[model samples]
Target: MTVIVREFQPADAAAAVRVRRAAAPYTVTTPASMVNEHRAAPPARRYLMLVAERDGEVVGYANAGLAYESSEPGQAFATPLVDPAHRGHGVGGALLGTAEEYLAGLGAREVYTWVLDAPECRAFAGARGYRPTRTLRYQRLDLASAALPEPPDVLPPGVELRTAADFAADPRPVYAADVEVTADEPTDIPFGPVDYEEWLADTWNDPLLDRELTAVVLVDGAVAAFSAAHTDGEGRYVSAMTGTLRAHRGRGLATLAKAESLRRARAAGCVEAYTSNDSENGPMLAINRRFGYEPCATEVRHVRTLG
Candidate 1:
């Protein structure tokens, strides 16, 4: 029987999560996030979540969509995966072809995706017209064995520690902090100005965002730095983003926030923590290393321009 690729259905979600996790274990994923992403994507995004089935079993999953939030025109993304148990088949190639065709029809002139750094994965992307651009390092810290720094007995002058939950009644300040930090992140594609409504829908409302586990730092009552926490609800936690406002750089605010977040996560029964950083982002990478995060995997970002 031929492998079949089609739009993901509600019934295919569990299989899709398994397939993606098998192919890419470095990132945090849950069935809820997977389904929420597909449902919450704005219409302008034109997001299409696709899954591949072979012999009546789902073995591949992919998502392709236009970059509606990007001010840069002709930008798009397509990330595809085939389960390790099913890679010998042509599922990956079939998914990519379909994704590219959809993107082309959407008037996207360039396509980007992250491929695992392994030789076979690199070769697969290379043969598919994608050229490597930047490398990202995926790091993991064994919270069970980590020697997390202890919070000081006395608070630093004029500094206060809080959790994202503290601002539940008014998350605008948290959203504002997110916007400022995200804009400064180093990336291949610049995220266009983020919309408040979209941010609320796609990020703040995510089921995995445990506000109580997310550490926030306040400098004189202003949101200065924070580490967003996403949990799998099963002892797996990821620091979605650790960022400090430009004004707060060099003060170790980000490091403080992330450390507190991780310590709290471990105490919350989380056994493992993971995060990714661009190889060139020396500051954040150093912070992770200081926190005992060891490199587990790497991904090479590849881009293909449509003719």
Candidate 2:
């Protein structure tokens, strides 16, 4: 069986989403989200989504792009995933090779990708010269069955809980909080200063982000913490990011935000909730566990240097 690798098109969105869902069940993705991501990619990212087809059926795909937000130049990323049913047929290799060639032509010096913790997945990456650098844990919460913690009926003095929707008129505060919290998250590549315009366009306006389900914690009218939520409109919700300002770290603000967000998601008809954290992010992981999120899968970030 010959696998043909080609650039992804709008018509391939559903097939691509299906392949991703089959390969990575713990993550939430939808056809619309896939198409929007491709259409809305920043030019600096040089993003390219490749689909691998076997006999006219898309069996795998790879998302390749430059890490434009990273301070380090020439850093790129390429994640190739093959449907389990189509594995061992060279689909993954073909997709990866095409992605690498494209990135190299764009002057990529190194490429990073996530490989499942399974033995076969690790072997495939290792054989291709990718070495593990960091581990990421994916967690899932059955929101429909979870006994989520109840928010206090009486609010703490000067504290308030609000949804992202409330900030529609002026989201700069949310944007500022995001910049502060994201800088503190653990990552191999250090992110450069975030551009407000870019953040507004790429994050705040993302098609998958459910502003109503995103909970924010305000301290004396200041954005202290927030939990960004994403939904597939199909009962699958994901915590895109949950963070607290440095001054509010130990006040349980992040937890409050996440709990409220989860509750909101459940109420909004979402049944499954998913989240991921860098293995080094103990605080967030502990918070997720407290929310009854169980470890569903793990993926290790692997890097391959290019000439």
Candidate 3:
């Protein structure tokens, strides 16, 4: 069987999303979200999405782009995922090879990817010169049945909880809090300051972002912590990001924000809630556990250096 790998098109959005969900069931994705991500990519990142078709049927896909937000240049990423039924048919290889060539042409010195923790997946990456760098855990919660914590009846002085929708008029404060919190996140590629315009285009306006479900904690009318929520409008929700500013750390502001977001998500008819965290991030992991999230799967970050 011949496998054809080509650039993704808007028409392929649904198929691509299906392949991704089949490959990583714990992750949340939608056709609209896929289209939005492709259309909103910044020019500098040179983002590209590739699809693998077998006899006119989409079987695999890859998302490749430079880490444009990193302080270090020449850092790129390519994540190739193949439907389980199509594995071992060269579909994944074709998609990944095409992605790597394209990224290298765009001057990527190092390419990173996430490989499932399964032995076959790890061996496939290892055989291709990729070395494991870090691990990430994907967690899931049964929002329909979990015993979620109740919010306090009396709010603390100067502390308030609000949804991201409240800031539709002005989101700069949310952006500021995001920047500060993201900077403290541990990652192999160090991130530089995020440009507000880029954040607005890529994140704030993303079609999948659920502003009503997103919860924000404000202290004295200033944003201190927030939980960004993404929903696929099909009973699937994911916590895109949840963090607290350094000054608000240890005050349980992030926990409060996330709990509120999850509660809102449940009330809005979301069934399953998913989130991911770096293996080294203990605080967030503990918080997720408190919310009855259980580890569903793991992926290891792998890196390959290019000449």
Q: Which candidate should be chosen as best, given TM-score against the real structure?
A: 3
For model 1, what is the error of residue 209's alpha carbon versus the real structure, in angstroms, after optimal superposition?
A: 1.0
Give me the runs in candidate 1 sitting further than 4 Å from their true place.
none
Q: Write the per-residue lDDT of candidate 3 for residues 1-307, one digit (tens) a residue.
A: 9999999999999999999999999988899889989998988889999999999999999999999989899999999999999999999889889999999999999999999999999999998899999999999999999999998898789999999999999999999998998898879999887789989988999998999999999999999899999999999999999999888799999999999999999999999999999999999999999999999999999999986
Backbone clashes in model 3, listed as residue pairs:
none
Which scores greater on lDDT, model 1 or model 3? 3
Candidate 1 lDDT over 88-165, as tens digits, reads: 789999898899999999999999998999899999999989999999999999998899999978777889999999
What's model 2's lDDT at 27?
Answer: 85
Clashes of each: 0, 0, 0
Candidate rank order under lDDT:
3, 2, 1
Judging by TM-score, tell me the better candidate of 2 and 3.
3
lDDT of each: 0.91, 0.94, 0.94
Give one digit per residue, the lDDT tens place, for model 2 in 113-199: 999999999999999999999999999999999999887898889999999999999999999999998999888788886788778
Q: What TM-score, over all chains together, does every model reach?
A: 0.98, 0.98, 0.99
